[model samples]
Target: MTDTDLDQSYSAVCEALAQVGEARAPMLLAMLCLSLMSRFERADQVLPLIANALAQSDEGDADGR
Candidate 1:
């Protein structure tokens, strides 16, 4: 996906989470991750992306969460 496509997708996800509200937002996001990951043929390809995401996480927050 291009940068524009990514931005649009991010906006859509934010809107969706907003609509789902805080209580069920985590479930919604988790379901989205699973749904997207289901399309990958190998976990090996996806694991690194997860790691990269974690690596880019909030450094200021001492607790990993």
Candidate 2:
């Protein structure tokens, strides 16, 4: 997809997550992650990528990246 499409898609996801609210967002996010992971041929390989992304997000919050 093009950059615009990606940007829009990410924005849409954020909006949807907001609608789910803080209390239920994490559960919904986990369900979405599992649904996406199930689509891959090597789902196991995706775990590390998810972990890395999460680590980066945590670091971003910690260091104000």
Candidate 3:
């Protein structure tokens, strides 16, 4: 997807989270991930993405950014 599409997707997620509120936010995200994962042809394609996201999350935690 293009950067513009990514921006739109990010905004959509933020909106969904806002609507669901804190209690169900994590569940909503997990559900969304599962829905997106179905579109992928293979686990191998998505495994690296999950790792990269975790790595980025770790870096964010390290710097407190």
Candidate 4:
């Protein structure tokens, strides 16, 4: 898919997650990974997803819950 298509897909997923509310947001992270992986042919696309995951993971770690 093109970058535009990927952006649209990302937006749609974000909307869906918003509609579902906070309780389901964590599950969508996997979908984001899969969607981004499938949509992006370039290696650069993967970096953003990896970075986001790492950032979120760090946040969770820092929260100490």
Candidate 5:
């Protein structure tokens, strides 16, 4: 990837790390996986979309009584 692409990716990683409050490595890894999966469907381009889906699922599980 070019420097701009690398910078964008790094910025995304930092953003995810700050939002999720986790180690940067795992968040970065998750981004990579999501980006790859995004190839099949467009959802991978952004992390928040995946995170929202997961959060919604968590809420559903909590309310599934």
Candidate 6:
């Protein structure tokens, strides 16, 4: 999928999470992570990319960028 498709899918997931409420947020995140993990042939290879992306996002949010 293209970046736009990924962004839309992410937004849709956020909307679904909102509908499910904050109390279930952790469970939902865990379920989503595990579901994604199941598809990886070499999780180690992709984990650094995921970690870097998350770190960048966190930094951007912190800096209000």
Best by TM-score: 3
> RMSD in Å for candidate 1, one decimal?
2.6
TM-score of each: 0.82, 0.74, 0.88, 0.45, 0.37, 0.67
* lDDT by residue (tens digit), candidate 6, 1-65: 99999999999899989988999988998898788878889979679978998999999999999
lDDT of 4: 0.83
Q: Model 2, 1-65: lDDT tens per residue?
A: 89999999899889989999999999988998898788888957898988999899999999977
Q: Which stretches of candidate 6 lie over 4 Å from their true place?
A: 53-65
Off by over 4 Å in 5: 23-65
Task: Provide the clashing-pair count of each candidate structure.
Answer: 0, 0, 0, 0, 0, 0
Clashing residue pairs found in predicted model 2: none
**lDDT per prediction?**
0.91, 0.90, 0.97, 0.83, 0.75, 0.90
With a 3 Å backbone cut-off (N, CA, C), the pairs that clash in candidate 1 are none
For model 2 the local lDDT of residue 26 reads 95
TM-score of 6: 0.67
| Model 1 misplacement above 4 A | 58-60, 63-65
**Ranked candidates, highest TM-score first:** 3, 1, 2, 6, 4, 5
lDDT of 6 at 5: 100
Better of 1 and 5 by TM-score: 1
1-65: candidate 4 lDDT, tens digit per residue: 89999999889988989987899888776676676588788889788868997899999999994
Candidate 3 backbone overlaps, count: 0
